[model samples]
Target: MHRARADCTANTSDPVDGQAMHRARADCTANTSDPVDGQAMHRARADCTANTSDPVDGQAMHRARADCTANTSDPVDGQAMHRARADCTANTSDPVDGQAMHRACADCTANTSDPVDGQAMHRARADCTANTSDPVDGHAMHRARADCTANTSDPVDGQAMHRACADCTANTSDPRIVQQCKEIVLLVLLTPVILWVVKPCTGLVLVVLLTPVILWVVKPCTGPVLIVLLTPGIPG
Candidate 1:
């Protein structure tokens, strides 16, 4: 049984099975004359003036404060509205355990499966068809529709070619000339593939015309790497 004395202002949970005079625990004050001798309990900010005559079990009691008071009590008694008291009433019912009520609902919502709470609002896996938008980058690929429409860039764009040539020519004068030459060779080889995607007609014509010129420039005695710098663009 719980018991409190004179002029109690705040109190917390009453002893579950106590029938004798009881007072609130956890710094709560109780009125000396109230029934059950005033069971005014307060845990932190949780105030409890639960009248046994009208037991508010599994539900928020008067001034349960924190606003986590549930109207209908749960079997657990008083804990039903614990989350609401702590300013988490948004997702109180069946909220994900241990996570904040608002965040847990975002993570578990049927439509949007956000992995890292406010980071990306898309699903981690592509199979979840609930969302109609395109699968963003870093999202898992869809099983049936393997078409990942994320990075469809033109292979041989002017900017890309310029960058590749820059990288190739930047370290040509270094002692590691062989490695540089190999990179240059790869660039030359990949030029056809990139151009084919962007401007097929122009890419093919350039490939036919520039292959011999580039091969000759790549001879053992390095000639001026000026051919790539002045490479002509085929008119679309």
Candidate 2:
């Protein structure tokens, strides 16, 4: 009779979900998407939130964030978002996590995943970027921002790269680099458009021909980096 009462209490509150949470846990362990496929994800989430007796660990929460990746249809975005939050919260960890997040997302896709999540990334960038008090990441940050703009076609990211690169340029404390970087980024974005308008060989030759003049104008502010950054455009 006592056991029956206990079972009734369990059913009244969580019912089968307390058991199903384990199923979701196993699903994560197996690296499968079953939880995402059904209510198991919801149950797992609710159980993780409410049940102190069976506390979920960081890895579990990490996988829980994978559900966000599934939503974006890109796994790395979710991981970067989760990791950036975890490492950058309270201004505690290194800025590399945040910077890496930006670069990693660029590799697959950028904030084009979701409008709401995109805002979160913006906030995440601000929070993470501010954590490091020094200007050490300036060069890397500049390159990363430029890379962010060059890699993705999203106009939002294009604007974001400008703003973020401005912050990065502050590391060098050179006012001229701002406009220089902007011009370089514009040239980067326009290269493909130019290629489409002309033959690949002609476009390649144009890039080769224009390279000296563009660098001469921008190199003082950009340092010697543009040569390496621009070289990958050559198909052969």
Candidate 3:
């Protein structure tokens, strides 16, 4: 009876040890599964973070490309603007060749006739007519007549003289004829004084002194007068 009791107690102890071993195996499987699942979740999170950062990096690269394009285009636009301004300036200035500008100036000056030379011719003509009967100084009379004819010759010349005379007569209280007469009077007054100062002691001295005086007085009066009188009216 004692041996059978001991055998029964041994069988009960073997069953308890089996249950404890089964429980330990179940706990170990649960622990291993938790660690594996946590590792898988961490890997998924890291992949998601990397994917999100890629888009941001792509956007940054795109912005950098746009900036580079804009920077390169700015200099090209500036160069175009500079070229446009240079073309405008070149068009406005005196031509780079210079000849065109000179020609234009010469054309302008040639078209507008001088007034002072015309007036002098008229005065010489009047002097010639008025002094015609006095001693018949052939050279003096011829010169004066030539000057008068030149100044009064063209219709346009006559008209211009009349207009100038009328304007001068009207604008100021002084008359054109009177001013001219005064100039003649002054010349006459100075003539005697010049002769007295030069005081020719011999015929040769007188001839020398008189020749230049005659030429000086006559040439100024005659050349312009001849030009005025001889030139026909320009065709329209």
**Runs with alpha carbons beyond 4 Å of true place in candidate 3:** 1-174, 202-236
Root-mean-square deviation of each candidate, in angstroms?
19.6, 17.6, 43.0
Estimate the overall C-alpha local distance difference test score of candidate 2.
0.34
Estimated TM-score per prediction? 0.21, 0.23, 0.15
Give the per-residue lDDT digits (tens) of candidate 1, residues 16-46: 4233323444454333223332443223223
Name the runs in model 1 displaced over 4 angstroms: 1-15, 18-26, 29-65, 71-111, 114-236
Q: Which of 1 and 3 is the better model by lDDT?
A: 1
Which 10 successive residues of model 2 have the least lDDT summed?
49-58
Alpha-carbon lDDT, every model = 0.36, 0.34, 0.23
Quick one: ranking by TM-score, best first? 2, 1, 3
Going through the candidates in order, what is the number of backbone clashes in each? 27, 0, 1
Q: How far off is model 2, as Cα RMSD?
A: 17.6
Best-matching candidate per TM-score: 2
User: Which regions of candidate 2 fall more than 4 Å away from where they truly are?
Assistant: 1-177, 221-225, 228-230
